[model samples]
Target: MPPCASPLLLRRRLSTRPPHREHPKLAALLDVLNPPPPSSTPLPHALSSAFPSPSDAFPLRTLPRLLPRLPSPLLSLRFLLWRLTASTPQPSPHALSSLATSLPDLSSSVPLLLSSSPQPLPLQHYALLLNLSTHAGLFPASLAVLRHMRSFGLVPDAACFHHALRAAGSAADVSAVLEIMSGSGASPTVPVIVTAVHKLASAGNFESARRLIDKMPEFGCVPNAVVYTAMLDGMYNFGNLDGAVRLIEEMEGSGLGANCAPNVVTYTCLVKCLFGKGRVAEALGVLDRMAGRGVMPNRVFVQTLLEGVCMEQRVADTYNVVERVVGDRGMSSEQCYNVLLICLWRVGMTAEAEGLAQRMMKKGVQLSPLAGSSMVRELCVRKRSLDAYHWLGMMEENGVLCDSNVYGTLLLGLCEEGHLHEASALGRKVVEREIHIEASCAERLVELLKQYGDEELASHLLGLKQRPGGLSF
Candidate 1:
């Protein structure tokens, strides 16, 4: 037989017999040389010796074409039927074998299954799709799935609503979310609704949030403690201390009292707001009120109060609060100590600030950037330049990454002490190390040098070529 005729006979046999059981070695060799016929053909008994049954053989050849034509809806139905009837179902040896034969085509099967399902897909399946869509940022597809869910007469539970709300929030389509919620005929539980409200409030849509709160009762949904806390957070976030307080009063009138006392977060929000508005006394009163309500102040709340004291320049009071907070709870957090350090420095209590820093280091309290920077400033103010430099180095050694502001403080301190050469060296080091230097600090250093009658030093420090007169040095 001619070489070409042998291949044609082998192809005819493969077309008639099962592709899987064909002579594996010989067919592999044939595939490399004489290609199969363009159209399928029946095999004679003589060719059957080389190839097996048609069932397995044809799929291997026709799969590429059939796969492209395989309707998704049909595939989904097949899957559903298989799943429903798969009691005591063992693994399909044929399916696995087919998969191995065409591994690259497996992905295409997924869309086929999804498109073919006649009824609504299962919730779990939808959830998986939703997750994929969310990760891919396919909002329109997710929304379509949601609508598909409703069309199938399926009511979305809280978790589904929560995921949808999150998707909507991410998309920044609050109006679309509200429309979906209203049309769904499904009322979200307290947690889901509160999350929606909080999202709106955070976006500064307090009016809409308040309206939602009012409408909650109409929906036969009562606000839970979490909802109240969310409202308080929103009010505080919007800088409406009065409104937040009024909401607190409403909670009390409704016999809710402050039993919830709001969490540490709520208290911190209110305290920070009061401090921002310079109502330090009011802020302190809120702290007292929180304590009276048996809501123990956490580290954050204590830190906020300490910040208020610092802002008010109440050094003695700030120290007292710090000591009280630390002693009462045995919680000497770095934030609390940092606040104390700032307060001591502002009040010119240099020794006290230094003592506090030492105590913090001994207690193993990690110093925040601001706190470490403040300590450096205090040391420099007292002409403890070596100590300041040592602390900055220690900070770097400990993996405490200092920002541009900290470098500015260090440079300013060095310049103020007339260590122009050291300051210039450090500035150059900063540029080399790619440490950001604040523009304000740079300007301030130049101004200070001019005031000290050191025009040449200022020019050198600023990397300026021409020195100007009438600079008021």
Candidate 2:
């Protein structure tokens, strides 16, 4: 056996372990302190006496569980400051959610959190405050939190900056966030710069936005195609079509490299904007230029062009555009026609839409999910949900995925038409796929099912509605 250790040696050995252990007495003290502010806060002598080792560090692990139980946000915040010194065991999401909800005004609480501790708060905690403040729509308070972080020499990472940017409501708000980023010596990335520019331009602060874009090189950030695309979007959104056109021309003439070249998105915006102004010929020219540059159009580009022409009641022009894109071999003829099907329905060309639908179904052409959904929707609108239900079966057999909205629409239409057996079959499909429908649709269907004495099926539909992770609209 080893010799017994001396008292000082024993103390030193004990100190190597975690400072404090989970203690029932401390928890009891906290429980008894309900709705009572400590005359002296942050482990007052009364509270400290309950700890096994009064001189030991606070038990940080117990704080997260006890946070919600605390009577006031101030007490919880005080405990948080104490634990911020240690890096491990960050606050849990539930704890943060509770704390954020309890605090009446985060703006005031931020300063209190900052001033309570002498040592710098961990960057994570500051990020938590920023997230809470911004998510609450308290943009000014979020800015203040960021300012305090900079004052403490803490630099926020990209994600934290994004949280603040999302909450920014105007040009001034965006500028303030950028100023904080600059002051912290954290260079904004290209995406961050684009978001800032978009925000500024959206508020009609075009000059400020332009200045930011021009100054990108100052921070070693080059404006890529995406950045230029955002600028074009802003100009078009603000009714500055000419400005957008000129910007695209400049982008085309810049000859910087592929990074600066107009891609599919750039051409899409130009086409949509020009089409919006009834310049169909000019829009076609832009598409020509895009093809000439060896930039291929994607599905969205084709969809936008089809929708634009369809909106103008240019049916022949619509088919011509589709044929032209199909000939380019960039997109399949089936996908192009699927998009045209959606466009035809949108423009209320019902006869043409029905004829095209019949041809596609007879040919067993694989229907895109959007096209399948569109066909079901149009049939239901004509009070033909029986037909919609059959259509869904065929689409499913062909392996076309139908989304929740499509199912819900058909289910509701069937119930409204008193087609119980069909609605029941669809509801079972919903449960089999574990899909969620709108709450309103589910409730209505459930009521009709129970009224018709289908108790078991009704409960299953309710289960679908209450299922975890189910997508509802």
Best by TM-score: 2
TM-score of each: 0.46, 0.74
Q: Please list the residue runs of candidate 2 whose C-alpha ends up more than 4 Å from where it truly belongs after superposition.
A: 1-121, 128-138, 255-258, 346-351, 377-384, 428-440, 471-473
Clashing pairs in 2: none
Q: If candidate 2 were superposed on the true structure by all CA atoms, what would the RMSD be?
A: 11.8
The segments of candidate 1 whose C-alpha lies over 4 angstroms from its true place after superposition are 1-145, 151-154, 167-179, 202-222, 252-263, 307-317, 327-335, 338-355, 362-473
Q: Count the backbone clashes (under 3 Å) in each candidate.
A: 12, 0
Error of 2 at 403 (Å): 2.5
Report model 2's TM-score to 2 decimal places. 0.74
Tens-place lDDT digits, model 2, residues 1-473: 23334434544554455433343443454543442554554454445444444224444334444444444455555545444444445455555555566554456667676666576766777777776776566787778777777777778887778778867998889988988888888888878888887777667788888888888898788878888788788778777789889888888885645677889999999998898789987886766897888988899999888888888888898888888888998688899989999989888888888778778878977788989898899889989999889879988888899767788789889988989889888878877987777667778878888888888888877766631123332
Error of 1 at 358 (Å): 2.5
